[model samples]
Target: MISVKNVTLRRGVKVVLDQASVTFAPGEKVGLVGRNGAGKSSFFALLNGSIHEDSGEFSIPPQWRMAQVAQDMPETTQSATEFVVEGDTVLQAARAEVAAAEASDDGMAMAHAYTALYDAGEHDAPARAQALILGLGFSVAELDQPVNSFSGGWRMRLQLARALMCPSDLLLLDEPTNHLDLDALVWLEAWLKRYAGTMIVISHDREFLDAVTQVTVHVDNARLVRYGGNYSKFEDMRAEQMALQTAALAKQADKIAHLQKFIDRFKAKASKARQAQSRVKALERMEKIAPVLADAEFSFEFKEPQNVPNPMLSMLGASFGYPAPEDAVAGTPPTVIVKGINRSVLAGQRIGILGANGQGKSTLVKTVAHALTPIAGEISEGKGLNIGYFAQQELDVLDPEASPLLHMQRLAHDLPAHLRAGQGTGEQTLRTYLGTFNFGGDMVKQAVGTMSGGEKARLVLAMIVWQRPNLLLLDEPTNHLDLATREALGVALNEFEGTVMLVSHDRALLRSVCDEFWLVSKGGVEPFEGDLDDYQQFLLDEARSQREAAAASQRKR
Candidate 1:
């Protein structure tokens, strides 16, 4: 068990936690939730002993082992499997002991070292590491790749796998689903559900919290408030508590009014003066209950398109991939991941593109958005077609050094002459446009590089909508956004008058905004027959098949 007693914490002059207390029993699954700057990360740091509280005490069992995902991306030449296997400190130490025993030619030491190896499960460590890596979304072939060969996002997934590989009594995960696709998210949910240790996770994904957490811990008003159930249940309970508090305040106010009325009438008469003085004292001693402040609510919408063109874009026998090396001569083949992609995106079509990571989902989106050229075949466009694209890597569309207002200025300046008409050149016009995305006054002048990921995402949305494009290609647009902002984006997309093709792991957004689904798998694109739930089951079956195949190959060897 772990206990926090009257803890006070501070960062600089800001008081993050004031007299907060909470307790966690063994094997309890708790969901930590709050606004972005509510000191959730600081609380995690305190539990890990990297931070000391300003006052009070926090205690955890000294004998219990802990595991948490590292935030730093590792730069190493080690193979992915070896890196993850090294997470089990006991297994690694035992293997080293066996090596040393053999080198020293000590039979007694060798016997003890071999025994330790067996106890540590050294023989099955590789298989265990492989299982974790595969479950977190790595291909069998990529298992042998060097750690440095993977991208930043994939490297984070490796870090998560390494953390899960550790033998621990307590597990801490902070935003573990940020980098995962829907398939891997589902797999992780299942894995965490079966974990035998105490787990505390911080996440903004409500559906994931509802599926995995048994309790909810809310960080609000510089204090920790514990609730009895998951996120939805907590919301319901919180609503009831606030309603009851409001009623109590109202009743108190009515009693005070009656007492004051009596005191005013009787204070003038000498006979009832004693009773009036008693009422005065009672009113003076009464404690006033403060009204509850409501949580901030955010909402916004996209401007209607300037034109709606039928069949906005179409592809015939198209191949999507990267171009050959610069040194290669003419006719050097391009590396194609998806081929024979014949599809037409009509006006107002809402399509959700689904696929595992590295299976060419982003490539297809880039191709349709004209960010990349199709290596073969034709991609025809309609008359007056306007494309608004949101890249998964926000840096692709944002200039880090520029301010939000400047980005809008560039967009206004770059528009075609006829389209630019009536759009004002004044700074007020730019500020007004950005304000809808929550960038007010001083925020409009802040540098994009210094802003948070959610702010950068909002800036990107503001830029995209300013042009009034007839088609939108959004890839993982909700990655940096919080739940409220994500809901706002979904509302805007649902009300949008243009065609949309979105690639996101946010199942809520996908289910709410998308009406049709396209599956990109095994180097081909096809239509899917069902909803998000059906797609989740398909992924489970696929993972099971791969596991069986790997086992068969291992037996053959």
Candidate 2:
């Protein structure tokens, strides 16, 4: 069992965990949740011995081995399989002993070393590592590829695989789904369920937490509050706790009233069928959890566009990718990921983009959003089209040194007055606009480089909506957002009277906001007739195929 007893922890001048106590029995699957910057990561650090408590006790069984995903980008020339297999330090050490025994030509020593290697499951390590890699969406052929050849997100998946390869008594995962697609997310949930180790995962994904965790430990008010059952059950219990307090009940009533007004306003509009349904669900959920998050500081909505346009955008056999460099050799075509996309997006249409990682979802979105020009075919936009694009990589669109107010100011200055929706492009208006997104007062002035990932994400969202764009092209906008913020984003997207094309792994947000689905795969984009559950099954089948192919190749070799 792991125990944290009246532990007080701090970083710099701020208190993170204050006299917090929590206990985890062996084989317990726990979910650790909190708002951004709530010391969730810090607590994980403490558990892993990367840091120490300022007061009291934090301890796990000394004999227990621990495993966690590495955050640093791996800079290695090692093959992906080799890298993951090395995660089992015991296996690595046993193999080293075998090598030493062989070199010395010591028969007795070699026998002992071989026994140790077998005990560590050294012979089956490759197969186990391959399963983890495949489950995380790696192709069979890519296992022997150099680790450094993969992109940042893929490398993170590799890191996750490495952690899973380790035979540990305790497993700690922080936002493991952030880099995964729906298919991989489903596979991981299943894998974690079968894990015999005590597990604690920190994730903003509600469905994921509900699926993998049997218990939830909420970090709030500078304390650790443990709740029984999964995330949904924790929510119910938390709501009940908050409702019992007279002060919280009053606040909850006010929030419910605010949400009810929005639901009533849009309930009768046929064009807003999806949005209305989503809003209704949000309202119902808010009633249960509103008091629990009475102190939540983040909220915002996309502004209404000045002019509504039908058939907002259309792509005719369009191909999306970067143009080849000027100095490129002949026969090297532009590097296209998505091609031959023929689709029409109407005003108020909410489309969710679905694909496996590296399947060109981002490329398609970037092309449609006009962040990248199509390499072939045509993309036509409605007259006076205004687009707000959120890149998957926040740093790509945000200046690290700039403040939120500054980003808003620059955007207002760059766009024409008409695009600002008649809201004058002035500092005070921008300041007020920032406030709506929870960037109030000094927070508005804080440098973007110094803020948390969630803070930066909110600022980017604020900047995007400030222009009152008629179309929103969001690529994983909820990546850095917490549960409350993700819910708020879903509500805002539902309320917006603009076209939205979203690419995200967040199932809850996608299901709530999207009326239609587009699958980007096989080097092309096409309308998907089914829903998110169908997509999950599709991923499982794909993973099974890869595993079979891997086994066949091993036999051939």
Candidate 3:
């Protein structure tokens, strides 16, 4: 069990936790939730011993082993499997003991070290590491690839795999699903369910927390509020509590007013002055109940498109993917991720693209966004079709050195002449528009590079909405957004009048915004008949089959 009593924590001068108390039983799966700056990460740091409490007591079992994914991106030439295997600290220690014993030529020590290595399951480390890698959306062929070869997102997945490979009694995961696709997230949820340890996670993905957490801990007003159920349950209970608090506050306000009235009327007269003084004391002694402040909700709207093109775009036997490497032979053919795609996106259509990572979900979205060309066939687009694309790599579209005003100024001139018309790119006009997205005052002048990831994502959305395109193609747009912002995005997307094609791992967003889903899998694209629940089961079954095949192949050798 972990116990925190009247703990005071601070970062610089900010008191993130003041006299906060909470308790956690062993083996509980906890979900930590709060607003963006509510210190959820700081609390995690406390558990991991990165910092100490400024006052009061915090105690955890000293014998408990801990595991956490490293935040730093790993740069190494080590094979992916080797890097993950090294996360098994006990196994590594045992191997080191064996090597030392051999060097000393000690027969008894060597025998003991060999036994320890065997007991540590040294022989199974590679298999365990590979299992983790595969479950995190890596292909079997990529298992032996160098860690440096993978992209930043893929490297983060590798980091997660390494953390899972460690043996621990307490596991801490911060936004583990940020880099995962829906299929990979499903696998991770299943894996976490099977873990026999205490797990605490911080994530913006609602379905993930609901599925994995049995308890919810909220950080609010520099205090930790513990709840008895998952995130959805906490929300319901919190709402009820707020309603009751509001009524109580109203009742208290009436009493305070009545006391003040009595004191004011009698204090002037000598006969009742004594009673008035007593009433004043009473009023001063009364503990005031604070009014409930509603959580800030971030919201922005997509402007109405200048024109809605019927049959916005049609993909007739189109092949979506990338061309061969620049170093490849000139005659080499382009790589086709999804072929024979026959689909038409109509005006006001809502499409949710579904697929495992690297299975052409992004490839299809990129093609539609005009970032990639089809390897074959044709994509017939409507004459007036305009696209507002939110790429997976949003930073690519933003200039780090530029401010929000500069970004909008450039966009104003870059848009088609028809859309621009006679509109001026005045700084005040642009600032007023950016204000709708909550970028106001001095924030509009802050360098894009210095802003938080969520702020950057909001800026991207602002730029996209300004285009007023008929078709919105968003790929993983909620990666950096908090829960409130994500909810706001869902509401805004629903209110949007034009077509939407979203590719995201957030189940809540997909369920709310998408009217239909297009599954991009098996080198082809087709309509999915069922809902997200069905897709999750399908992904689980496929992963099981793959694991079995891999195991059987190894056994046969």
Candidate 4:
């Protein structure tokens, strides 16, 4: 078991954690939850010895091994496989010693090295490494790829894979699913459920936390509160606590009012004077219970345009793909991923694009946004049509050195001549736009680079709203947003009067916002008329049919 007692942590003058105490038993899976800056990461840092608390006692078993998957990666020039192997530094050193001993002919040195390596479990190192790498979704070919060649998301996965490879009695994971796709996330959920050791995971994904954790540890009001069962249970418990507090406050208020009336009526009489004085003292000494502040509830309202024309956009016989390097001419026929695809977007159409990763979802969005040229197709636009494109990595477009307000200013200045006239040109306009997206005065002045991923996503969304486009193209807009933000975006889309085309993996968001579905399969696209739930059922039935067909093929073979 691991235990913490009387822990107090402060950053400069502000206390992040005060007298927080918690315990984790063997085989316990706990989910840590709080608001964005509620010291979730700092708490993990304290446990990993990366930071020290003002006052605390943390105890763990003497023989216990610990591993942590951090948000940031260490700078290193190593391959992915080499990086995971290096996680067990002691074992690696032992193997190195064994190698050196075998090279030497001296019997005495060889015997000592063999004994040390055996004690460190050097004989089984290769098997352990292979199991861990495979479990974390790394193929043998991918294991040899250099870490520097991977993107930020892949680097995070590498860090998690390395942490899992190490033998540990206690595991600390912070937002492990931030970079994982659906398949990898499902695998991780199963792995953690079957793990024998204790785990503390900090995540904002409700479904993920519900699947893997058995308990919840909530940090609120600079204190720690433990709840039995998963996130859903904790939410119910919190609601009950609030209800009880409300009732107790009401009863106390009634008693206080009765005492006040008695004092007002009997204070003038000498016989009742003593009793009235006592009542006054009791009132003064009573501790008033403050009502709990409500959690922020987001309700988004999109600014609807007055009138939008039909046939907002259309593509005729469109073909999209990258240029073939084998062709000598630059303008030669491009290799087509999709061809003879004719589609139209009418006003008030909420279309969702679905396919496996790398099957050109992003590419299709780019083609619609005019970022990519259609090799053999004609794209037609209706009159008075305005378009807003929200790229999956739209937050990365912000200038690191610029403040949010300054970024807004740059966008305003770049508007077309027809749209730039008669608009207010002050910081107040920018501040109002920022406030609409939940970024207040001081936060609007902060550098965009300093904001968290969720904050950056909000900033991108705020900028998009400023354009007030009639048609919105969102490519995985829920990627970095939390549950509240995702829901907020969904509400906005639902209220939007214009056409919307989105690509998202969040079932809840898609179900709430979209009214139609588009399935992008092998070299073709199909339109289906139904809500998200119907589409999901169709997908499952199709998958079942394919599985049965594969089984039949195998029998014939």
TM-score per candidate, chains pooled = 0.87, 0.93, 0.89, 0.75
Give the winner by lDDT: 2 or 4: 2
What are the lDDT figures for the candidates, one per model? 0.82, 0.85, 0.85, 0.71
User: By lDDT, is 1 or 3 better?
Assistant: 3
TM-score of 4: 0.75
- Local distance difference test, candidate 3: 0.85
Q: Name the lDDT value of residue 124 in candidate 3.
A: 76
Candidate 2 TM-score to native: 0.93
* CA deviation > 4 Å runs, candidate 4: 70-79, 88-97, 100-143, 243-294, 297-299, 309-311, 323-340, 416-426, 505-508, 511-557
Error of 2 at 505 (Å): 0.4
User: Candidate 3: where are CA atoms >4 Å away?
Assistant: 245-294, 421-424
Q: Best TM-score goes to which candidate?
A: 2
For residues 1-557, write the lDDT of model 3, one tens digit per residue. Answer: 99999999999999999999999999999999999999999999899999999999999999998999999999999999999999988888999999999999999999999999999998778878888888888888888899999999999999999999989999999999999999899999999999999999999998899999999999999999999998877876775675576666575565445434433443332133332233233223221211111233455677778889889999998998889999999988888889998999999777889998888998999998889988999999998898989998976668989999999999997888887765567889899989988898999999999999999999999888888888999999999999878866765675578999999999877875676789988999998877777889999998888777666655675
**lDDT of model 3, residue 396:** 66
Candidate 4 lDDT, 420-524, residue by residue in tens = 455565789778877878888798889888988888888888777777778999987877786557645754675577889988766545554555678776877
Cα RMSD, model 4? 13.6
Query: Alpha-carbon error at 194 in model 2, in Å?
Result: 1.4
TM-score of 3: 0.89
Candidate 2 has which clashing residue pairs, if any? none
